[model samples]
Target: MRCLYCAHAMGLATCPLGTVVPILNRPENADILDLLNIPKDYEVAINMALGYPTESPEPPIRYSDKIKIVL
Candidate 1:
């Protein structure tokens, strides 16, 4: 999986418009809302670290439609 942005994980209780601060000046233990001074109900997407397959993966069995011009 790849890394994704999550406000809650970043110490933010709520984020508006899924906007996450590129840089936070508050401590890691501090809540993101407290740092940003945002009201309640604010939410932002989550930043997550995901690991994808190291090697190329084959397509599913139903992918035959992708071959429009078969030689």
Candidate 2:
């Protein structure tokens, strides 16, 4: 999860920020893991596809305004 987050941050830092799509468990993924020689004991965390955006959308409004800070 940490690695995925780091990769996601880097991907988003591009000139035209790219989207990071996470791929979960799939039968073909097992073959890929084997090809990469990833140990069976270790599970695949995330498979991300980074690419430019096709459509531009407004950023979601964060609800941080509602959170109260306790000093």
Best by TM-score: 2
| Candidate 1 per-residue lDDT over residues 1-71, each given as its tens digit | 12233543444343233233433323462487666565545543443333443454554566566755453
lDDT tens digits by residue: candidate 2, 1-71? 45555654665422321232123245556766688787877666545455545565665656769965453
Candidate 2 stretches greater than 4 Å from native: 1-29, 67-71
* Clash count, predicted structure 2: 0
- Residue 68 in candidate 1 has what lDDT? 52
What TM-score against the true fold does each predicted structure earn?
Answer: 0.20, 0.38
The local distance difference test score of each candidate is 0.43, 0.53
**lDDT computed for candidate 2:** 0.53
Worst 10 residues of 2 by lDDT: 13-22
